[model samples]
Target chain A: MADAAAAPNADQYEEQHVHEVYEQIASHFSSTRYQAWPIVKSFMQELEPGTIGLDVGCGNGKYLAVNKDVFIVGSDRSSNLVKIAAQHEPHSAIIADSLVLPHQPGRFDFAICIAVIHHLSTPQRRQEAVKVILECLRDDGRALIYVWALEQKNSRRGWDEGDDQDVMVPWVLKTGKKNPMEDGATEKTFQRYYHLYRSGELEADVNAVGGGVVDSGYEKDNWWAICCKSESFTKASG
Target chain B: MKVLTLNFLTCAVKACKSTSTSFPLHPKDCEMVSDTIEPNPKLLYNILPRVNWTALLTTVAELGFPELPPNPPTIEELQADEKMTQELHTLLLETQISEGCLVCGNCGHAYAIKEGIANFLLPNHLV
Candidate 1:
C-alpha cells in the first residue's frame, strides 16, 4: 500500500504542493526586509559591472529591486511566484522550470540557484537540474548554488528507514528501520536530505560535469558553492 | 635601366616573402588571428551535440541575415531555399566565432569576444 506521502501520483502532488507553499511565502516576503536580501547582496557585490545574471528559483523579486542596473532575470516554476516576480520587477521575470530553462545557450554570464536543490525529491533530479542550468551559461560563465548541507548538525531525522533496494533515499535503510507511516509499505515517507561531502566529493561532482569550484562557504544551515565552467575540461571532452 | 629593374624586382620579392613570414604587428597578434580562424562547421559538427536554435537565429539576424525557418523547416522549403538551408547548416554545424559580443537576454551580461575568444571569467564572489 502507498504511504500518504507516496500515493500513486505522490511526486506530482509534492511538486505542486511545494510550489503552492512557495507562492504563499513569496506573497508575504516580497519586500527587501525578507531574509534573502543579505544573501543576494553578498552575491551581487562580487559581480562585475554590466554583467548578466540570473536568479534561479528566485521566489520573489526582492533581490532584483536592489540590482536593477545589471541585466538580471528572475525565474521560477510556480506561476504564482512568477506573477509576484513580474509584478515586482516587470519585464525581468520569467515563468520557467529550473530543470529546463527556456533560454538560449551561453545566454547568461552568471546563474544563482538559491536554497532550492534540497527541496528536490531525489539527487538525480537535483543533478539534472544543475546540468540544465549549466547549459544556459556561456563557456566561461559562473554559477552560484545553495543547497542543504548533509552535515551532522544539518541532517534531518527520519531520513534513513526504507527498503535497501531503493536508491532515491538510501538513508532510509541506515539501520533496517521500518517505514514510519504504514506496515509493509515499500514507499518511504521521510523528508530526504543529502549527506555532507566527505572531502573532494563536491569537487569531483563538479569536475565530472566540466565545472570547477571557484569558492564555497556556509551560512547557518545552507551550504553555498560557486562554480565556473572549465574550458579545458569541456574542450577535452569535445 | 635593366639593372634598376632587376633591383626593383628583387626588392619586391624580398618584401613579399618577409610580409608573408612576419606580420607588421606583434607576433601575438598573428597568433590571435590564426587562432581566430578556428575549425569551421564541417570540423565542429561532430564535437558539438546541441545547438540553441533561438540563439542561432537571433545571431544570424543580428548579422543582417534573414529570419530562420519556423520551428520546424519544411522539406519543400529546405529544397528550394538554398540560403536558408546554408544558414541553418552553418548555425547547426559551424564552430567559428561569427560575432564579437553576446548580450544575455536575461541578465544582460555583455560577453565580449576579443580576438574571437569569449572571456567568461567571473569575480570570485560572483562565482
Candidate 2:
C-alpha cells in the first residue's frame, strides 16, 4: 500500500510492468489464453446476431473468434497482440489504451473487459478504467468486466481473504533451443502488478463509477460482473 | 483497420471528446486492400442502423472511394437488392487500410496505421 501510494507516475509504472511485459511476451501469453472462460463464452453467445461490441484488453483476440455473427472491435495496449487479433476476419483490432479508448461515448451496443482491471496499480485508476468502459456503452448497452479475486485459496497461488490485495504476480518466460551447441533452456520471471478484488469490491468499484451491476459472480478464481450505464448518471450528465 | 472500424473511431484525446469534428478521422496517404470476405447480408442489415451514415460518407470520400449514396439504404432495401448488399460488403468489410495516418480535425493529432492496425497510443505529453 505504501509503495502503491507513492506511484506518482502510474502511467510510467504500468508502461514498464504491464505494457512492456505484454509486448515482449505476447506470443507466449497468447498461446496459453486460447480457451475462453465459460461465463464469458455464454455471455457472448447470448448476444443478438447483429450486435456490435468491443473486446477491451483483448489479448490475442481469442474471444474475437467466439461468435462470427456479431462484429467486435478488439483493442489492446500491445501492438503485437493487436497484430494477432487483426487476423480474426470480419472483426477488427487496433492498438489502444483502455483508459482512453478511441471509441465514441455511449455509442456501442455492448462491451466485454476480461481480466483487465486488476493490472491498474491504484484503486482510483481501477475505478477510472471502469468509468471509461461504462462511458463507451449506450444507455441500454451492457459491459461485462472480469478481475482477479483475492479469495482463491484453492488455486495455485493460494491467496485468500484478508491478504494484501496489491501484489506482484510473476510471469515466467522460458526461452532457449534444444541444440548441441547451445546451453539448456533458461527462465526469466517478470513481475506484474495486480489488485485482487475482495468479496464485493468489484461491485463497489462499479457503483463508484456510476455503473449498475446487473449480474456478478465468481468463476475460476476470478470475479466477474455484467454492468450497464446507470440511469441516474445519464440523467445527471445529460 | 477496416473502413468499417474507422467509422467508429475518433481522437483518443480527452479534450476532443466533446468536439464535433473529432468523429470520422480523415485518412492520409492510405494504402488500401480488398480481401474477398464472405458476404453476410444479415450482419450488414443489422449493422446498418447503428452506423453513423454521415461519418461513414466522410471516410469513404476521404479514402477516394466512389461516392456512396447520401443516405444509408434501409434494411428492406438492402435485403431486396443483392448488388447493394455486395457493394456495402465491399465497402465496409472487405476494404482494409493497410498503411496511413488518421488526422483529428479537433486537435490535429495524427495516429499512425501500419499492417492494418491503427496505433492510438498518445504520447506522454498528449496523455
Candidate 3:
C-alpha cells in the first residue's frame, strides 16, 4: 500500500486493499483471531448488566459471548464475518460499515472498536472513524479502541517507530488441495492495509475527534485506549 | 436479525439518523422464524427499559403480532408475571427475521435480510 497521505482515492484504495481482502479471508481470519486480548476481555466483563453496546468490526464475535448478561450488537463490513458472529447467542451481528453504522446516535452504553480503525486509509478517515464511534455513545458511554502499534519491534513484524505507518500486510490462506502442477498445497496471499499507530497516536486521534481518553495502555502488539465523548462535544451534539 | 436488534437499528444513511421516522425500520415481506431459546427474565427485564415502546408497537403490529399494551410493563410486573416474561422473551430474542427487507421509513432505503443477518451496507450514493 502507498503512504496514507499520498493516496488520492482513499475509499477506493481501502475498498480494494482492506474491504475486499477481508471479504476473501473472513473465515480464515476469524479462525486465527479466536484468542481474546486480556484488556478487551476485562473491558467487556466490567460493563454493568443490562447495558447495551456495539462491537464495531466484530469479526467472528468472539467477544460477544464473553458476557451474557449484557447485550451487544456486533457489526462488520464483511457479511461472512458477520455470519460467523451472528451465531453468538443473546447477541446479534449485522453487516454494516463502521463509518456509517445503522444504530441511532447517542444511545449505546458502551462500544468496542478493536483493530478496525487502522484499516482506514488516511489519518482523516481514521479520526472520522473514531468520531463516528464517539457519536454512537451516550453522555456517559465509553468506548474502547485498539490499533496495531508501530512500536512493536519485539514482535515478528518488527515495526519500529519512524517506520512507514501505512503498509500492506499479507495474509496467506492455505487451500487444502494437492496442486496438480506443484508439489505443495494451493495457497493465496491477500494484502490487507493497516496504519500502524505510533505511541500516543491512538489517544491523539481520539482527542482529534473530540473524545477524551479515560485510560490507555500498550498490550501485546497493539495500542489500546478507553475513551468517551468530551463534555463539550456531547453537550453540543445532544 | 432478531426483533430486539431491529429496535436499536435505523437507516444507515447519515441523513436519516436525525429523523424520527428512521428509528425502528419497518419490515416488509419479512419471513419470520421463532427459535427455541431458553427464557431469561432478567435479561428481558433489563432490556425492556431500553426498548422504545412506540417503535416496538409499530414493529409488532406490522409483523402481524397481537398489539401490546399502551405502555411497557414495569420490571416488577414483568418479574411477577411468568407469562409476560415468556412472551417478551419470545418477542425480543426468539423471533427473528429470516429473509426479507427492512425499509427505512425516512429514506425508504430497504436493507436486505438473508439467513437472519441484515445487510445495512448502503449504496455509494446513499453513503
Interface RMSD of each: 26.5, 0.8, 0.8
Per-residue lDDT for A125-155 in model 3, tens only?
9999999999988888989999999999999
lDDT of 3 by residue, B20-81 (tens): 98988999999999888776666778888888899999999999998899999999898788
Q: What is the TM-score of each candidate against the true structure?
A: 0.49, 0.95, 0.95
- After superposition, which runs of candidate 1 have C-alpha atoms over 4 Å from their true positions? A1-13, A29-33, A37-40, A87-91, A152-205, A231-238, B1-127
Best prediction by lDDT: 3
| lDDT measured at residue A124 in model 3 versus the true structure, 0 to 100 | 89
Q: lDDT score, residue B110, model 3?
A: 94
**How many pairs of residues collide in each model?**
10, 1, 0
Query: Candidate 1's residue-wise lDDT over B41-75, tens digit each?
Result: 32223212233344345444544545765464554
What TM-score does chain B alone reach in each candidate, compared with the true chain B? 0.42, 0.97, 0.97
Provide the lDDT at A65 for model 1.
58
| Share of true Cα-Cα contacts across chains kept by each model | 0.00, 0.79, 0.72
lDDT of every model, 2 decimals: 0.47, 0.88, 0.89
DockQ, per model, reads 0.01, 0.86, 0.82
Residue A128 Cα positional deviation in candidate 1, in Å, after optimal superposition: 0.8
DockQ of 3: 0.82
Reference-based lDDT, residue A170, model 2: 89
